[model samples]
Target: MTKRRALLSVSDKTGIVEFAKKLVSLDFEIISTGGTQKTLTDNQIETVGIESVTDFPEMLDGRVKTLHPKIHGGLLGKRSNEEHVETMKKHAILPIDLVCVNLYPFKETIQKRDVTEEEAIENIDIGGPSMLRSASKNCESVTVIIDPIDYETVISELSETGNTTLVTRKKLAAKAFRHTASYDALIADYLTNQVEEGEQESLTLTFDLKQSLRYGENSHQKASFYASSIPTAFSIASAKQLHGKELSYNNIKDADACLRMMSEFKSPTAVAVKHMNPCGIGNGKDIYTAFMNAYESDPVSIFGGIIALNREVDAKTAEKLANIFLEIIIAPSFSEEALEILTKKKNIRLLALEMREQKDISEKEYVSVLGGLLVQEMDTLVEDETTWKIVTKRQPTQTELEALVFANKCVKHVKSNAIVIANNERTLGIGAGQMNRVGSTKIALEQAKEQLDTAVLASDAFFPMADSVELIGQSGVKAIIQPGGSIKDQESIEMADKYGITMIFTDVRHFKH
Candidate 1:
């Protein structure tokens, strides 16, 4: 009987010596290449060089080592087919029972601060993927292993039964394909990022599973979290949880919304979110004051919401946050005393992020439809007031201009058909996702009833008709701001002029779906 043969070529040399020793103990001939063979021989484990099997030396800087027909024939030959056995025997090719291969650290290399395009290209593995695919294609005759964590399991199975089960081989084959696909995606993403204008017209995105969540938006729906392979500094996927319970699906979604809202302000800002919409948002002299102002925006709606702070959490703010029934709190950092006080709430999830002065936004945003994807550039353009037109006769005061800009920023993140009522950099009422513009105006007006006379209202888009303008004007909305692109813009401007309401046209629309 022929002794079992195993080929090992890996960049991550984790537990290779012990695994090879176990295979040698099982009466298997260990065939290895380059560093793997050197390590195995250094550890006194018997092994044969891969060149001995191929009858050729590794050349072209180790790129042409495993593309030989001898290696692939051994992996792909079928033992049950007599013709394949005859062909293999005629070529004097011995069957390889197991293949253990892992690619180079392409992802790791590209993450280096000073890495160049040429360096990234050089790290891409060629022969490693070829051998793994050949073995995976003939999984019924050969076992393929790519992850180091599976070494013990394979050793245990071979020790007990002298071979791996078909089920195990199939599962490993699936993982091998996933591994290669992820590797190729990383290479593609890196190259795409380096391409200049007019060179490539599309982007390739890939996400690796980060973790399996308990459920999706609802408890009954299954879900998992996948993160971009390219590293980022400000994404919620990379946040470090300092204390408290694991974040749920809803918690992550709400936290992301809260972060985006908070990112709109340069000053110390706070945003509270519930059900993927901002319940409250404010900027103040300090983070604690900002938190208080945001909480005051809507005390009832912020009860079980997530809070995001753009500054470090101090002891005073943490004490205030502790009193509320918040599901999550995300901040740049936390004072030691603040962490001590906040950790008392065992169920509240706490995350710490590194605040960046200018966060990088990806160019494309994808929304999945029934049978396709709706792709668009990210809505990251800054609204320039210099480009705005003051259509109404009355010019807005400095205070009104500040309030209008603040409200406009807040409304940009709200759902479509949105209206936001704000004053002094604080959101008083936000009506979002309404079917009609009048309905949203009514909701925001009612929420800011007490402050309507002093508040400025911001409409995410032009009022389709003059009814929305009439509604806000009658409700004592001191000023109004909108994109002003509707064909009936004159009608809305006339209504604002009639009511002496200051109106400005940004000439830019922000319609969030």
Candidate 2:
């Protein structure tokens, strides 16, 4: 009978000594490298070093130790082949039955505030990834472990059955490949960003699973939540769910929309989102007024929608929020009274997230299209009247200007062919995802009703023709704001002048599809 051999080399020493002790108890010889050897030997567990197996000392700052053929041939050889066993006997190579290895902490090191290129480059692991790949490729005979969380399960199975099943080995092998692949991707993305001129032709993205949802957008589909590996303060991935049921796919999408819309305002703001579009948004002297204004914008649309506010939710605001059947409510914090009032509703989800200015964590956005991907830089540019071009005879009044800015912010989050009509920092009506500009205008105006006379409209993009302007003018809207880049821009401006309306061109277009 021959003793099975296990190789253990890990940067994270979590539960390694106990796991090694379990293998020793199972009559397995443990071979380790560097700190792993030191820790195991210190814990009264017998272990052999890589220097003994390869017959060479670790050199070149500890990079050349595990690249020897003796180490790799042992991991890559097949036990099913008679010729493989004969060759191992001829070369004095011992087969490695199990490999426990984890790569360097490149992702965590690069996340520091002042990490340099030299520091990041030095943290990239070489021998660790090589060993993992070799062992994973020969998973028919070798078991590979990359995550420390799986140590207890693997140990328990080995102790009970004297070996891991083939199915468990295959699954662990797949996980090992993904672990090394993600580690390499982080290094690739970091180096590419160092170039000052242009971006890399290909995109490398990595996300860690935050939680698995009960289902996707539909109950029949599967779903899970993934957070960007890059760190940032203002993301749903990092939000804390203070109470209520688990989040669904639709809840996450709508909550993100509400947060983006809430980021547009400096004052106390509240935004209500439905189906990934802003149904109502408002700002006021206090968060209570903001909540009521946004809720009253379109009460029917706000039902079952998610609400996000920029300030701490108070008892008054929580009372109003609990009045309707809502899906989720997210804010920076909740007052004691507010929590008491809102907690009464057992099923409504309450999330607490401190809002911050969103820095460019990743400057690019990727969308899958058919067989390939479409990539573009994120739209983080802030647009205001500083670069606006007012194209109408009657300039907007002070009050109208404020309303126009608010409406523009609300419109940016709406789908294409979107129209948002607002008054006194509160959205009066919103028409989103329409086929044509006139159709959106009619829906927004119809929803505003008597408020149309004093309400202002914001277009997400330029109106190609004058039909939308004429439609809003007939509805008695006093002011309009849009991006003016159309060939018939003069026509739209003339139409605005004909009806004695104020029109401003932001020169920036925000088209969200």
Candidate 3:
């Protein structure tokens, strides 16, 4: 049997000494650098320093250790080729059969509030990625391990077969490449942010793979979850699933939508989502009342929908939720009694998302388009009596004004071009994702039917054409709230004036397509 050689370099030393001892027992020469070499040597396992093998010393503050051609040539050379063997013999370079490397903890280091720019830059690995990539590129000849968690399995495989199989090596190489890619992305994003603080042109995003889902939107497609390198206040990707089956693609999408909506409310709120749209949302004195009100909004649509609560779920709410066939329930916390009650339903997915402070107001909203993504400042503007401008002859009552504000809040969360019709505190009708503003207004009024006579309408954006105003008038909507900024705004105002309808301009558009 040929004498195999394995190089090890890792920031995480968990299980390293034991692994090195096992490899030594199997007669494999252990090659390592710096701290890794000391770690193995201190454990009484013989190890050769990488500098000695390369006939070069580590320089540039240990940054130039593993970048030598001898190290790469050993990893890249093919054992079966006579020409490669002769070249290695001519150069007097030993073959490296395996490479195990994990990158520096740049992410962990930067997460420290007291970390300086110099410290963050120092954590960016140079020689480690070069060695990993060189080893992975020649996976047909060498095994590359990027994660320490896989060390035991690799050692077990080698012990059983005397070598890692080709399939295993290929898998490990793919993992190594992904690790390097994620590491590089993090560094790039950090540098970009440091260079350009407030400009949209300088925005850089890096997302790390969190978990692979069961499937995509459909059973045929594949899907995975990626979390942003920059942490957010309350992200579904960061949430912990306490119990139940794996989340499907649809579940996560709906859950995220619901969570974003719930984040807007300060009171105890509950939102029920179906197919990435809110079926029901209500705020009440307590979580149980909120959930009950949301459920009562549309009980039929709540079936098999995802439910999210902004407050801790109590036993009363859990019992009510258990009676239905919901897909998932996300809340800040669940009482022990609530968990016991909910656990009786075997298929419901439960998640506990710790609430954090709201994100900074400056974070822009992003939406994916055909070829690129659209980024704009988030619409955090809210309407009050001072911000509302009444431009029509008719006046709104206090109750109608309150309903208008509530309906406007609902419209902001809906897909554009959207219109919401509500009376009192309950939504009477919602038209979302329509082609035109008029079309959405007509749909909302039509859904309200006779109730449109007294219901207040809230539009996400200004009506470019006066047809929407006429349509609302024909449907008997008494009052309207809209973000007025269209060039043809005067035409819409005239139409509402002619009908003697009450109109309030919020002056802030919320287009959420």
- Ten contiguous residues with the weakest lDDT in model 3: 354-363
Stronger candidate by lDDT (1 vs 3): 1
C-alpha RMSD of candidate 3: 3.4
- What lDDT tens digits, residue by residue, belong to model 3 across residues 1-513? 657899999999988898888888888999998889889888888888988888998899988889887898899888888999999989987899989888889999988989999999999999889989988989998999887788888888889998888999899999988888878888987787789756645545667778898889999999998777766657787778987888888998999888777766777778888887777777778889888878876678789999999889999898999999999999988999999999888788999986545564346677889988878776666445596798778888988887787788778888899898886545677788989887888777776785666689999899998999998887778889998988998999899988778999988888886
Q: Who wins the lDDT comparison?
A: 1
TM-scores of the candidates are 0.97, 0.96, 0.87
Q: Tens digits of per-residue lDDT for model 1 on 331-380? A: 99999999999999989889999765445654466788998777787777
Once model 2 is optimally superposed onto the true structure by TM-score, how far is the C-alpha of residue 347 displaced, in angstroms?
A: 0.8
Collision pairs in model 1 = none
For each candidate in turn, give its C-alpha RMSD to the true structure in angstroms. 1.5, 1.7, 3.4
Which order, best to worst by lDDT?
A: 1, 2, 3
lDDT of 3: 0.84
Candidate 1 accuracy as TM-score: 0.97
Question: How big is the RMSD of model 1?
Answer: 1.5
Write down the lDDT that model 1 would get: 0.89
The TM-score between candidate 2 and the true structure equals 0.96
